[model samples]
Target chain A: MADQLTDDQLADLFAGLRADTVAAVLPPGADAARHTVRRRRQARAAVTGGLAVAAVAGVVGVAVAGTPAAPPAEPTGPLPTADRSALRDLAESVLPPDARSAAAWSFSLGDETSNTAGELPAGSYRMVVACAGDGGTDVLVRWTPRGEDNLFDPERAVVVATGETACAAAPSPATLRFVTPRDGEVMVSVEAVDGAAGRAGFAYRIVPAR
Target chain B: MALTTDLHPPPETTRAVPDFDELYAAHYADLTVQLFAYFGDRQEAQDVVQEAFCRALARWSSVSRYDDPVAWVRRVAWNLAVSRWRRARTALGFLRRQRVAEPQVDGPSPERVALVRALATLPGVQRRAMVLHYLADLTVAEIAQREGVAEGTVKSWLHRGRAALAVQLRPTGTEVSRG
Candidate 1:
């Protein structure tokens, strides 16, 4: 019985248990070393750069030409479903698959400048922006197929963030988009243009599904 | 003043890196054995210890700088084992009553069973103190610091714990030996 064991005996017993515990804990092959990190990096880069753009456009703002030479995306296309939810989900996904959002927040951003850019956090952020009649019913069109600033606005939208360590919000030539490159998180702002007093809005957070 | 956003390497990267392979070779056997003592269930203890270490790897930067990295990991592993024990305790409340009172049970090897039985008898803090003290080769002062108690308190625990263990194994006080 351990109760009857001397301190020396118990110590020896404890030492013996330590050895057995570690061996039993690390079953053979239950290590990350077995997994291929090289392949993972490649796959990550693919989705990070290319797929991220397509996903972001499909998810956040409407693509508009940014050549600074190109004209405004004619407030033409029916303002992306006055309930613009696709755009919100897209913004949130800009974060690397790990950010969540607070109930509400406010950010200072641009609207009709033909682009959205900002240095925001890096995480999964659920962003939703409403240009409700602000700036006389503006259009949230992601005009071009690719998301580029020089092709649209050389300004390269900049987003400076302050909050959770990693808040990912990828920026575009137009409205700021969340980008999840690192694992940190942060909150940011996207000013609504011509927004009637309270219309120009943007929200984000690191919210992951799994 | 403008905020300084200088990006420095994480603490783990900054702290001395351990030779994982060497650590594995040198201490693997001993660490495994000690962890097993914490939880008589060999398989579960192994899993927790391994996972805890992997986590340590993942956050090596933060954990390496800790006052005692190895001790830090042991503590993490210990916490995980405790949580697992709590869960098992709740779920197996009924089955425990019978086997617990008996001199023996029908699971695991005899050595493992005996060790666990003995561990179950010690107070939670004492068990932890004993484990860290013996397994990590930490002294009473270090244990006191880690456990957030005075050296005197640790001595008391060691005294009481050894006495109880002595009675359990060496009923006649002939000093039951383990090695």
Candidate 2:
């Protein structure tokens, strides 16, 4: 049956299906969507801001009593800075104590790949990638020996290692360990594997392997 | 003053960000349609897509800078649809035992209904592969990357899904002989 039907025929069928579905459903207007989002953001900020203030007050009270106060969690403030710091901390937490940072990058990861590269001497290293977002997209991490120029050329460069980590509020870092054959430039790239379009605050670091 | 302003003109970095309203208006209906085909519920599909847009709006400052910001909204919407469908499936199972009658809505064309039903028969991975390939117009390599599977795996899923749909939708007397 499949041999009898052409690719165009199947595509037409699916296209028709989409058209029919669209006719049956009416999506909300952009203004409505924006209003709802703004309201939700305000509500969430109110709740989280209240909690953060209470937590800080508790820590200050403890210090006033002359108790040996533990270090307080990072205060939440602006969205971009807070997310960057949180993702950086998450990426750093996965590194070994003796690991020295070679290169680090922070970016808003979408469907397109994000890359960061640096020169390194001959040594074993660990690459850690972390992402945080509202969606369930997973970030794929690929390490290649050549610069970005040859990153896509299979003949010119071979991918050393690959791993993936989910994008979440509390993300599990993806780590890859590989040894450089010779001292040269190396590139690491990250992209969302899931087809859905969403954005995440992503941070990655390269450190000496213990 | 005019010469100095022309020389500097402030930074154009913010120009890279896309307009949220335009993006939302352009993609809302199409994304809802895709989600509707994935799960056989139009209202749920619209709701999930709306929720995804809402999430994107909350983080527009960063999301708008992405190379393909619409892709982010699409992914988030699909993720929401998948999770919601899972929860609905569980509740539906219990409701079936109680013989609950579902609310009636305007129906789709018979052919569309048949295609969706055939798609529903497929495994989740195969269905997703079919939808992404056929509807989303993604290449085999793109589908493989999205699914975290090899190209061969994605090809196999698409082949099997097409075969299953053909078997289900083929007419009783239709047959073609290979040369």
Candidate 3:
């Protein structure tokens, strides 16, 4: 009987699906979207401009150069031991002062691991994943609700947010901000891009947005 | 600096870019619906669409100058959805080995679920072709241009995809069980 269904019938079915789905969605408003884009722009500008260097110097009491105009060259061999405290300081320098730490961890390239940050009420939070090496390495970071922590289980994990950042001489970091839909524990997972599992150390911290 | 130039193009060379607010207002719901039909997850679809808009806004100076800015936004949203889908598929495979069943959430109508399930069974390219053709009202040439394939390839995909959907949705077949 289905063989009798024509193209018009299939189109009608799709049209019905479209109407039902569109009616159920409530857009987060253009104003809210504009605000998000503005915030992201400011963050990227801060990172790439002199503001990041100034902030780091102010917080750490050391002069730091602006991020180089040219891309940092890739490391050929093993990287130096990651300075955890220094990386943390660099990460915190770019975030709001009131941001409270929820979880922090360190890992190497080619390793996929996750950290659970207990339960958090519906609110905004920031994730800072930093990589410290001579140069060229990137890490993928993902956030998912806790019980769904099977980093391998994509269907159920329902990733709330994700980002990627390259490693650099300084603790080059990729920062992502997201809001929890409801009160729930969340897990943050980090995986390095495929390559030699060089000791290019990485660190990530999750904190509540002020 | 190049960044400065990108942010503030010369007045003489600048074109009349569409208002961001108006663009968002006009296309947000439609784009979200298209993504929802593609992925079968309302929240995820909305998120990806919103993220795509955010990206467009960030690069508005460049994006707004495009011949069809909405196409840029749609492409970005589709790219994001595809990346997430790939990650999910990888995770689903691992979980399948562990015998962990994903929790099902109730929302869509029975008819919608049946169609979505049938669509899900098709290969990714074919399913995408079906949705883009039937739901988005895109012609074969348009889909071909967007997908960077020949129009004949798109026609074949649509033909095969429709035939498969018919078999899956047959009334007497066990494939689509009605509620």
Candidate 3 per-residue lDDT over residues B41-121, each given as its tens digit: 677789999988876775454456666788778877986786666666665657543432344454567677678778878
Order the candidates by DockQ, highest first — what do you get?
A: 2, 1, 3
The lDDT of model 2 is 0.58
Residue-wise lDDT of candidate 1 within A38-157, one digit each (tens)? 233333222211111223212342222111111111122223443244333443344333334332332222222222323323333434332212221112211211233221211122
Query: Can you list each candidate's DockQ?
Result: 0.15, 0.20, 0.14
- What tens digits encode model 1's per-residue C-alpha lDDT throughout B42-69? 5556666665565454334334445445
iRMS values in order, in angstroms? 15.9, 13.1, 13.5
lDDT (10s digit) by residue, model 2, range A1-210: 344456667788898987777676666877887788555444332222111111110111100001112222222223565555665465445433433788776665443455566677767776555555433222222234534444433223434554434444555455556666666666665543222123346666667776
Q: Please give, as one word, the docking class of candidate 2.
A: incorrect
Candidate 2: TM-score of chain A is 0.48
How far is each candidate from the true structure, as Cα RMSD in Å?
18.1, 13.4, 15.1
Number of the top-ranking candidate, with TM-score as the measure:
2
lDDT of 3 by residue, A76-114 (tens): 444444553444345444433333777665555432233
What TM-score does chain A of each model score against the native chain A? 0.24, 0.48, 0.50
